[model samples]
Target chain A: MSAQDTVLVVGAGPAGLSAAATIASMGKKAVIVEKEDVLGGAPIISGYAKLVPSGEWAKDAIGRMVSRVEGDGNVSIHKSTKVTQVAGEAGNFTATLSNGDKLDAGAIVLGTGFTHFDSINKPEWGFGTYEDVLTTTQMEQMVGTGQIRCPSDGRVPERVAILLCVGSRDRQIGREWCSKICCTVSTNLAMEIKEISPSTDVFIYYMDIRTFGLYEDKFYWKSQEEYKTKFVKARIAEVTKSPDGRLLVKGEDTLVKRPIVIPMDLVVHAIGMDPNALNPEIAKTFGIGLEKHGFIDRAEQYTNSQGTTRKGIYVCGSATGPETIDDSIAQGQAAGSRAVADLYGQQKVAS
Target chain B: MAIHEKTLIDPDRILQHDHLVVDGVDVSGSWNTMITPRTLTDYEEHFEEIIQSYSGGENVHRCWQCGSCTNSCTMYAQNVDFNPRYWIYLIRLGLKAELMKDKDIIWQCVSCNKCTNICPKDVRPEGVMKATAHWLEDNGLTPKTLSTHFDEEFTHQCIEFGRIEDTEVMVGFFKRSGQPLVQAWIVEFGKRLTKRLPLGQLAKMGMNVVFRPKTKSWGKTGEVLAEYVKAQKEAAHHG
Candidate 1:
């Protein structure tokens, strides 16, 4: 096949899957590489409960993307692999995968999505120390099991506190960007816990609730009016343990200028998204620029949201920044279109 | 002020410069005052313990300072100075002098239990308010507030008669609070009560006052409870 025939897509998450499917529909070969043995990304492996806006089951939503890419003959998914090496620039590139397979493609798309911020980094949150102390990923896994219980004793959690911005938006830790999804996720998880067990009092402590846009703001308000979930305006300072294995969260209620201490059965840290670790290696291989925060910078963020600093190579999804699944898919389609357009011009020249 | 918590800078720590430049940058403004950092050594140790010794201050230590109590406080609505969460914080830190700033209004809590009902940490701030008020009087930090006088006199009746006599509680409370029983409002209220009530109902109310209602089975429970209260007070006092 010619260099313009196949479009290389990295990672098999929603972004990569959508990119590959879009390229495949354009009658071009699409190759996808993932670090894990699974097709879906972090959400699939961690096991999410529900998607926001529509509130669809994450399993079914992600399953649809998996099937779309799997059914396409033009698309090839290489699971349990990663891009080990890349050569050439822009329109023509050769990538050597961890599986030792090489591919010559017209354009490259890095859809390597973000990973959850490690809660261990913020020791004050007491993430790994307390069995009942969990991050959103762990809480999602627990929620998948269909029971809200203290991880320490397996007893039902009478009270659960979700603290937002665990690792994000804190100048002390060098992360000044908002993760953008924690507010919605924390709210949804609180609602889910309350729905699963009505007796459970779910409290969310946030510096500010940024349920941006139309849909997410509705869910936040609905949490207060419909679900009766309590939103406390206190960024918790510390999580200490009680004598009875319960967690004590300490923070001042900024609204009342009062200090509060409450014992909780479980403490869920709504950790934010950090740039994927593979970003540095990928940037090194492809000769692209990464922002100070480690995510790839857009060539022109306003006009070319998916276009990276390097020509022919593009980026979509959380590879560039914190993005929802829907946004990742949209970026995937845009990257596919950009790749196909570049390849089409080259194909005409070759003919 | 580079400080995130502006309120944390107490009044004494404020340092205002009339006309000063720091590293060639003029930092003279109404809002740009600096704080003089000072190590605190005047914390009232055992303040939390003493408050906890009272009826409702048991969970004061559990307070992480979320301010939910003050946010939902009924008294705070009337006057922002009526802050339960702030007092709880001061009690925990043993900031006795800082707490004394709001001594008079500490007893202004309406006992609405809004703070307690909405407290995420179960701080039971209504109880804390009473406890703090009692603490203030017990320590002679302030004179007995009307609420404290009312509570003590009411509790005395309960300890003695097993139940509260509304009339006796009112009379005892007014006398202890230094308010005359026959005030203009009280006489008007009494006139309204007497004008609206039938003679038979009035007679029954008078008879009930003469022979106070006693719990038939509260034979030794009252004495036991009174003794228990006394022991608790002694323990707290010793602390």
Candidate 2:
């Protein structure tokens, strides 16, 4: 195939894998460069428990996507590599990989995804201070292992408190946007916790239960109705230790109109998403603009939804903003189609 | 929190045609109830501040009405109309007329603190309940409730003797509320208590009731507390 027939896909997450698969299916060559040694992105890398909407294990679900791209002959995979530089215009471009490999591509699809908000920034919530306080990711790992025990000691937690919006929607932390998935994920985790240890009572403290779309009844209501997980409308102010060695979640129970300090065996922070840490460097390397929030800037959403500020360069998934894995895959496919069409359109004009 | 509750819709506004046919379609009873749209104009702009002027209602302005208070409410479980979230919404919107609709039940808060304990915004809905109930009585919209009368009697005992004389407090409550002291429930309760108690303990209780117990160190403490309470009440009312 000519250089103009190849599409360079960045990152090997759900979005990137789908993008490459879509490009290959469209009868075009796809060069996928993933910085991580392994593929499947956050879900597989982070070892997420079970995906929301579908209770399938992250490994099994995202693994299928990985195998599809890996099995495709039209796609060339480069692991532990970065696209260091992009030179030339749209429909004909050259990309330099970190592994000293050079690639000629017609268009690029960025599916770099996002970084899970680190709970250490919000010190008062006690991620680092208390051994029992864990992030949702860490809790998911425990769920993946099918072991629900307090990290402080090898004891089954009697009560687990899942605090939502730990990193998102907090103006104090400067992360004003909703992370979008945490509410559903937290509810899913709550049910998982109840399932693993039926005796353990799980309480999810949320500002607003934004299990949007179909996820509302499936995750939120199901967790409450089926699993018997309690949903509290209190955003915890602080997570402290009680005299009895149990974690203390301090907050005003707005319903009861009283400041309450509830003791828990485990406290989980439903950490939000932040723009991928490598976004600035990626934007600079790809000659793309970054939005004010630091996600890749979309040129115009109306006509070209996947088009980044730079023509022939498209952005999808959490690299643009906080997006679900399923939506990101759809966006990846959309970006792939856009890249292929733009390249073919250029060739049609040239011919 | 649900912004629009079923209770907010007045029964009068809901018109259901028993038998009707419209445009070749037969629209029957209850399926299609036409609710007249309510247009509110008499909103007190400073209603939130007015509620804030009362104790416990100070944080009434902080309510985002997430319904956590109502969801975990002890009173709401008993009566759906006892919705703290909806009342808070009305208070915030300065819907005085709408609020008056639920004035009778507002004083029925069991003080369970469930709503306050679960509220995300620290909108102490329990305190708001107490404040709202007190506001109603202070404005003469509601008569002093039996609960308020009981509270006054209990407070009177505490101030006079630095202790609660349960029998005196109950008698005082009945007197203030214009209820007969020899109620059937009180008689049944006395019979149960006598069955559970020994003769010696019963005699001691009778002696204590006859001669009201007083704390020895309560010298002038009652007067100080009474004066402080008076001043605080005056400030809260007028300030």
Candidate 3:
């Protein structure tokens, strides 16, 4: 494998696109395959400003990467295409694409990100049963549309309840792993909703408030002090529909050991993320391995987060594990450098 | 709300003793020596053997006693003492007497299958509940109210008719339970008036339940079920 060798990257999200841009910058032929008609994956669907380290807009960061990759002649992007079949050995594999086209690659990187956990599985959350109850994704769309009205009545909600950990940290539902990002995302949404509608009451039911790193003080102060969002430390037991079309949320205040039922005009389930549904298919097709929890298993945590068990194949971002945008970008760059090192037989570039 | 006064154990004093006795029973075991050993060794042994017999029951030993299953149970949503996880734990720990005390809770399951679906490790908590119910029936530990009327009536109806006739089953159930038989007719009449009778929607309810078809080989199926139970008992004894 050389600089002229083509490296195929699956997915066009931050991780895949970052890898493509990095590879092209290093003068390698990089090809990106995206299943969606447009790029940006969940971010576009979410319609939120990405949280950068410097509090900069995520679009600006993503726009820079997209320009670099698209401007480079070595990088070829294939939208509305999926890799149907992967065959051959490491360093000389063939990917049979969806359009009956085949591409030969010296190295491959899997960055097919995670899918949102289906909140309806937790039926007690009243996700599908109540029209007023929406998912975090749906809430984002509402905010994007510049109105936060109850889906049932098309009226501005006077009382809103956001339930955290709908599909995360719940052993009874079998998803014990912490989704890590939902806390900050929910807290941020709560603040935004309050800023838009100051009189609207927002209550967040959470098992625990996990605001890790620099976002910790910001999340805590904003929700607790600034926005005055009522934080209740309890896991919701059930969400029922009231005769008036409001959602009746029931849960025990763990500290008080007493049940509390609050009626709200609207409810939001901050659902977690699971490994992409295509993870198993990709693992079998590429001879990679999956963890017990179904995410692609990295070879080692410390030294090989990007590298999988198979040689010449690297995995990064949410495909390997749950991560924020900052972590995904860093891992993407590292994976690109690692793939380059594997091809060139030297670690010249600082990842 | 009023807080009731009760005898309080000194936490410091209890920590000093390696073993504690509750009502003349030894509490010392592999993990918690402070609590009384409510489970018997023989019962624990048999429960483990039965669990090991089923592929789905293999995760029974992985219970960390977190009480998450019991806390999240839909049955417990209605009844406070109907803790399925605790019952399963009792079975694992060989607390047969404690398990037998809550036999009614075993059948109270609506089979919502929510517990198994939400189990973090794919523990199949519902299967454990079913296994416990089956174990109670095999051991004859089911309460008289549950076994004498409900179980006997259901078993008799299935064995004799191959399928249960709702009206006949209700009448038989009421008669055996010392209730009046005419009550069943009143209920049936009320159901018929509301167009809720099963026989009325025979075509929609599926052919098996609507027609009440007799099993061609009822005897064979009964024999197979009996043999399976006997084999399980033998294995439990050896185990």
Best by DockQ: 1
Interface RMSD of each: 11.7, 16.2, 18.7
Per-candidate DockQ values are 0.03, 0.02, 0.01
Write the number of the candidate with greater lDDT, choosing between 1 and 2.
Answer: 2
Tens digit per residue, CA lDDT, model 3, A80-134: 9999988876667788999998998878887788988998799888888888889
Q: Per-residue CA lDDT of candidate 1, range A1-351, in tens?
A: 667788999988889888999999999999988889988887798888888766888788888999999999999889888888888876688989887888899898889898789999998888888888998888888778888888788889888889999889999988889999889988888888988888887778888888888645477766754565666667888888978778888877675465667778899999888998878888888788999999887787565657888778888899988898888989999998888877875422210
DockQ (0 to 1) for model 3: 0.01
Question: CAPRI verdict on model 1?
Answer: incorrect
Candidate 3, pairs of clashing residues? A172-B118, A173-B118, A174-B118, A174-B119, A174-B120, B39-B94, B39-B95, B40-B94, B44-B94
Question: Where is the poorest 10-residue window by lDDT in model 2 chain A?
Answer: A342-351
Which residue ranges in model 2 land beyond 4 Å of their true spot? A346-351, B1-239
- Write the candidate numbers in order of decreasing lDDT: 2, 1, 3
Ranking by TM-score: 1, 2, 3
Superposed model 3: Cα runs more than 4 Å off: A1-4, A49-64, A347-351, B1-239
lDDT: the better of candidates 2 and 3: 2
